[model samples]
Target: MRTIRRALDLGCDFFDTAESYGPFVNEELLGRALRGRRDDAVVATKFGWEYEGTARGALNSRPEHIREAVDGSLSRLGTDRIDLLHQHRVDLEVPIEDVAGAVGELIAAGKVLHFGLSEAGASTVRRAHEVCPVSVLQTEYSLWERHLEQEILPVIRDLGIGLVPYSPLGRGFLIHRWVEDS
Candidate 1:
């Protein structure tokens, strides 16, 4: 909680959390921390997996599941609308268009401000964007992981979609030694 307060103090506002993280714990913490200050922050969360009493199951991005997941996320985050809602992972069973369409409905209904995608390929990004504008694309990108540079980057850049690179420090690999040294 102190760390989150410190970040907010330092003008850090964008916060990203997912339903899968602790299956709900992290979002709860964030919701509590941002209490009375939700307007000052941009909250981003994801929903793509099925959960059975806190036990995460397989990828399930079905339209109906998406609706249920967002409602759960809204309640957990204690927010009326999500600043940015992402499809955590591209579900092979559910078509990208369907996923985008579902999110589009949420956006139209004023439940989500913007749409995002995570770890999605170029083709999938394009298809989803055709259904609904992809405001941002979050992927594992850093010096150590340059896979997206060749294909995904170009596509997102061409589409004018913003990129939110996760694990920018190589998921702590760049700081592992630093932590050990400390």
Candidate 2:
């Protein structure tokens, strides 16, 4: 709790939580922590993974599921609306368009402010954007990790989507080598 408060004090207002994380504990903790200070933080959470009790199971982004998930998340987070909501992973069983449309509906209803993707492939990103403009892509990218550059970067650039490198420092904190950024 103290750590989270300290982080917020340090101007790190952007918080990312997922329903799968702790199978719901993370959001609960964040919710309690941000009680009176909700406006001070920019909360971004993810949905899609199913859970049994505290155990995370499989991906389910079906339209109806998306609707139910947002309500559960809102209750857990104790917020009226999430600042940003992301599809935790691209569900292979569901069409990207359907998933995007579900989230698009949530945005229209004011349940979500913006939508994004995490750990999604290049092609999936492109398809989802057609339904609802993707505001950001939160993927694993860093100095040592450059796979995203070859395929994902070009598309996000063309679409004017933002890139949020998951671990910009890679495994280690230091980036001794000069990496190219274009």
Candidate 3:
């Protein structure tokens, strides 16, 4: 926490967290850390899954749920506005436009600055963008996971949306060559 605080003190403006990570513990930690200095950082957090106290997965992206999720996120992060809010995963149960529209409303209400999607396909991305301009697309893209390069990357680039590649190091596999066997 001290190291992270030092980095934030030195002008590190962006931070990302997800609902699945600790199922909200991480966001709470960030909220506590940034308490009075919330304006000094751009806190981004994601939502999608509902953890049932056993690590079980269930997708819920209904409009009402999105609204509720944002409120919970705000309360957890102790912020009035989220710099960027992302749908951690695509919910096949809901229409992309509906999801985008919900986020758009939040943006309009000044609850969220930008909306994004994670691990979404190209077509869905297009539809979502049409409903609401997406500022970023978070996905796994790197030398190993070149799948996005074939379709997703082109659409994002052509649309002028930034690509925020998570796991750019392939989950530490990129540095495997440097690890010596015990």
Candidate 4:
């Protein structure tokens, strides 16, 4: 709790938490941490997991669950809109186009401002971007993680999407919010 507060005090407004994180407790924890400062923060969260049977079930990114997921996130985070919403992982059970479409609808309804993908391949990113312009791609790419450069970076560059590499030092949880001094 103190660490999170210190980060916020240091001008860290973007916070990432998934419903799957502790199956719900993380968001509640952040909500308490952000209590009266919701307007001053940018909350990014993810969808695509079966929260009901979290400990024992499969990933669920079906279009039918998108809105409900967002609603749950909003309620838990105590926010009306998500600044950057991500598909935690690509779900084979659901088509990428359908996931994009679902998130696109959320944008139309003023629930989500931007869409993103995590741990996804280049082709999946392209397919989803065709349906909804991806503002960012959150894949692991760092000192020891350079796989994205060979293929993913090119597409991200071509599409003008931001690349957010997840270094183990900093997992793919809003690391984009931090920038080193030039």
Top candidate on lDDT is 1
**Ten contiguous residues with the weakest lDDT in model 2:** 173-182
- In Å, residue 74's CA in model 2 sits off its true spot by 0.7
Per-residue lDDT over 1-182 for candidate 3, one digit per residue giving the tens place of the 0 to 100 score: 67658879798978999766788888888888888888889888997777677384789888898998899889989899999999999999999999999999999999999999999999999999999999999998877788988899899999998988988888888677557542
Taking all chains together, each candidate's TM-score versus the true structure is: 0.96, 0.91, 0.93, 0.87
Any idea what lDDT model 4 has? 0.85
Each prediction's RMSD over C-alphas, in Å, is 1.1, 4.4, 1.7, 5.4
Give each model's whole-structure lDDT: 0.95, 0.89, 0.89, 0.85
Q: Report model 1's TM-score to 2 decimal places.
A: 0.96
How would you order the candidates by lDDT, starting with the best?
Answer: 1, 2, 3, 4
Cα lDDT tens digits, model 4, 102-137, are 999999999999999999899999999999999999
TM-score: the better of candidates 1 and 2: 1
Ranking by TM-score: 1, 3, 2, 4
Top candidate on TM-score is 1
lDDT of 1 by residue, 1-182 (tens): 77887899899999999999998999999998998889989999999999899999999999999999999999999999999999999999999999999999999999999999999999999999999999999999888999998899999999999999989898899899789999
Give the TM-score (vs. native) of candidate 2.
Answer: 0.91
Error of 2 at 14 (Å): 0.3
Q: What digit string (tens of lDDT, one per residue) describes model 2 on residues 62-145?
A: 989888889999999999999989998889999999999999999999999999999888899999999999999999887778
Off by over 4 Å in 1: 180-182
The C-alpha stretches of model 4 lying farther than 4 A from their native spots are 53-56, 168-182
On lDDT, the stronger of 1 and 2 is 1
What is the lDDT, from 0 to 100, of the residue 120 in candidate 3? Answer: 95
